[model samples]
Target chain A: MTELEKYIHGYFGVPTDDLAKIVTFFKPVSLKKGEYFLKAGQLSDRLGFVQSGIVREYVEANDKEVTKWISTKGYFVVDLASFVFHQPARWNFQAFTDAELYVIDQKNYQRIGQMVDRWHELEKLFIAKCFTVLEERVLTHLSMTAEERYQQLFAFNKELFNQVPLQYLASMLGMTPETLSRLRKKSF
Target chain B: MTELEKYIHGYFGVPTDDLAKIVTFFKPVSLKKGEYFLKAGQLSDRLGFVQSGIVREYVEANDKEVTKWISTKGYFVVDLASFVFHQPARWNFQAFTDAELYVIDQKNYQRIGQMVDRWHELEKLFIAKCFTVLEERVLTHLSMTAEERYQQLFAFNKELFNQVPLQYLASMLGMTPETLSRLRKKSF
Candidate 1:
């Protein structure tokens, strides 16, 4: 099975025949390091699942870039509002490293219903997963201290510290680089 | 048409026949003020659409309750993570006032597919709307000042200021009651 198939099965466990049909909607694509899958102000046209490498999502606020997330393999990346509503994108999606992705265009995404009988159930399950992830983020931000947030992310992906810029992680964690540096030292 | 039907039509624009079929899944339910729709640590077994009145969602932390949101008329209420994933609910949902609601248990919610062939499309549109709303909230929290958030909410629903306790609003806005008070005074 392809990595994309593996991800879909692991994430949603769609039946094998249905999985075979669903996989056809996605087309493989790649980006060099620092290239963008999407930029702010453009309408999002596709949703990409990361097969390898890193993608950074961020937004500009008062002349400063605020990192929303740095997604690695086994993640889907898109400015969801833009993709669904056809609104101008608010977040920039860029490759932090040379990345391989499986992309589904807007047209094919809309065609999922025609291809499968239980597509709504699948879509609801997919979206519910997204909502749960967002809910957890909100909970963590509201309940956890900055130190706890930093520690949780570090524990989840230690490689992020070595591979990506600390400033980006700091912004994503809603802390300053100085505070993150202090926490890093304290952890040691 | 009832307020709930009007909302479903206005929001999703599902066909007349499909709308009738979809509405069957929801059964009318009412709650007295201060009654919980779902409590923390319980499984969220149903999703509710409010026809009227207010519902407050909150979480307990360090012996303090932090308000997450105050849902008013024409809004859907649930612990989203629990409803979708069958996970333990993270927030407690309670009626802040005598509330008229239309609720769909998970079994009925999942049964929509057998009722309508296009149910997936309608459901996807519905979920995409939820995701976009969540995205907007995240953007507002990250980008807007606390005072700006207060002003925005006040402008959108001034009645909430008088009907709900200020401390719950303060918690939802991620500010101390003292800070919220200061901002309110400054605004006036």
Candidate 2:
């Protein structure tokens, strides 16, 4: 099975026929490090599922990029608002490393929405996951100190953090790179 | 149709039968201004859809309450992580007004998941809304000053700001009540 097929099976245990139908909607794309999967101001209609490497969603703030999320292998990466609303994106999606991703267009997404009886279940699951993450971040921002958030991040996604850069991670954690470096020393 | 029925139909637009099924799952709840909807450490199996008045999701940080999100009639409110994972809540949900709510238990939520195909689209729309709010908050935090965030809040949800308490609004804006009060004075 392909990597994308494996991911679907692992999550949904979808039958082969269903998986093939899903795959027909996808177009594979290659991205290089420093190249964007999707750029800000562009119309975003494709949802990219990472087969390999990492991607980050970021928005520029006074020339500094604030990283909002990091999408690793087997994860979906898209400016969801832009994709669903058919608008120009305020966010930028860039690869952190040379990567392969499967792109699904809006038409195909709606097609899948029509075909699968269990699609809603999967969609609900996806929304539930998004809510969980956003809630966690809100709590972290409100209640936890920067150091505490860093510790929590390590505890929550230690594996993913091991591959992410200090700068991008610092942005997501809502700390300066200098502060992150200082915390790193104190942590040791 | 009742106000509650009207609100649900406006948000989800389900058929009468499906709406009735959803209505059957909900239990009516009322709370005074000072009362809580759900406390920290409670299982958030019940998802509350606001029918009247205001509610806030909050957490205590250094003995001070930090508000996260505010829900009014026509909005959905829950400690989403707790609800999705079937775990105890880390945040407190409280009423800022004499509020009316309709709640659904997890079992019924799962039942709705099975029974309604459009329910998945509702879930997706709900999650997309959450992401949009989160994205906005993150952007406000990164790109704007505290005063700017406070200003943006009005621009984003003018009616909500009018209904919610200033302190809670300040909390959601990630500013001190004193700071927000001062900003409000400067605005006029």
Candidate 3:
């Protein structure tokens, strides 16, 4: 099975025959490093699941870019509000490195319901999972000190420290780059 | 139609018969002022839709209480993560006033899917709406200044300023009580 198929199967637990049908709706797409999958102000008509490499989602606020997330292999990338509600996108999603993705457009995404008996249940679970992840992030921001945030991120994805830019990571953690540098040194 | 039924009909756009079926699952419940709907460390087995008065969702962080939300009539109240995942609750949901709610336990919530053909679609939209609201909150917290946050909240729900405690509003806006006080003075 492809990585995208594995991820969908693992996350949704669709039967193999049904999973195969769902997988066909997603087409393989690639992005060169620094290329955008979607830009701010555009409607996010498609959702992409990363098969390899990293994608960064960020928004410009107060003339500075704030990183919202760094999605890597096996993670899905989309401006969810735009994708679901047809709103103008608020975040720009760009390839941090050359990336491969399995993408399903909005039309195809909706069509899955007709083909799969339990698609609504699976889709609800998928959205709920996304909501839970977001809630955890909000809790961390509200409760954690800058140092604690840095330590938690480090423990969760140490590889990101080496692979992604420090400023982006700092922004994602809601800390100044200088503070992140200080935390890194203190940790060592 | 009851307020809860109206809210369900408006939110989900379910047919009259189907809406009636959905409404039957939620029983009327009331809490006296200062009583808790749910507390930290308990599983959130039920979700409530506020019919009257207010409910507060807050968590103690580093010995300080951080207010996550002040839910009013026409709003749903639950530690969503705990309710959805069967995890121990993180926030304490207490009645900010003598509140009436239409509540559905997990078992009944699950049964709605079997009873209503389009229940899953309606449910997905409900969760998606929740996620979008959360995304907007995260964006404001990350991007807006304290004054800007206060101003936005005031414009959105001016009545809350008089109805809820200042300290709770301060915490909810991610500012100290002093900062909130200063902003209130400045606004006048």
DockQ for every model, please.
0.55, 0.50, 0.63
lDDT of 2 at A166: 86
Weakest lDDT window of 10 consecutive positions for candidate 3 chain B: B136-145
Score residue A68 of candidate 1 by CA lDDT.
83
TM-score of 3: 0.95
Candidate 3 CAPRI classification by DockQ: medium
lDDT of 3 by residue, B1-188 (tens): 87878998888878888888888899999999999999999999999999999999999988988888899989998877788778899889999999998899999998988999888888888898888888878778667788999999999999999999998999888888999999999989
How would you encode candidate 3's per-residue C-alpha lDDT over A32-146 as one tens digit per residue? Answer: 9999999999999999999989999999998988888899998989887898789999889999999999999999998998989888888888888888788777777666778
Q: Model 3 chain A, poorest ten-residue lDDT window?
A: A136-145
Docking class of 2: medium
Which pairs clash in the backbone of model 3? none
| Candidate 2 C-alpha lDDT tens digits along A119-154 | 766766766777677766776676677899889888
Give the per-residue Cα lDDT of candidate 3 at A155: 93
Give the share of true interchain contacts found in each model: 0.42, 0.45, 0.49
The TM-scores that each candidate's chain B achieves against the reference are: 0.92, 0.88, 0.97
lDDT of 1 by residue, A128-156 (tens): 78877776676676667789999999999
In terms of lDDT, model 3 sits at 0.89
Give the Cα-based TM-score of candidate 2 against the true structure. Answer: 0.84
Per model, state how many residue pairs clash.
0, 0, 0
DockQ of 2: 0.50
> Considering chain A alone, what is the TM-score of candidate 3?
0.97
Give the lDDT of residue B7 in candidate 1: 88
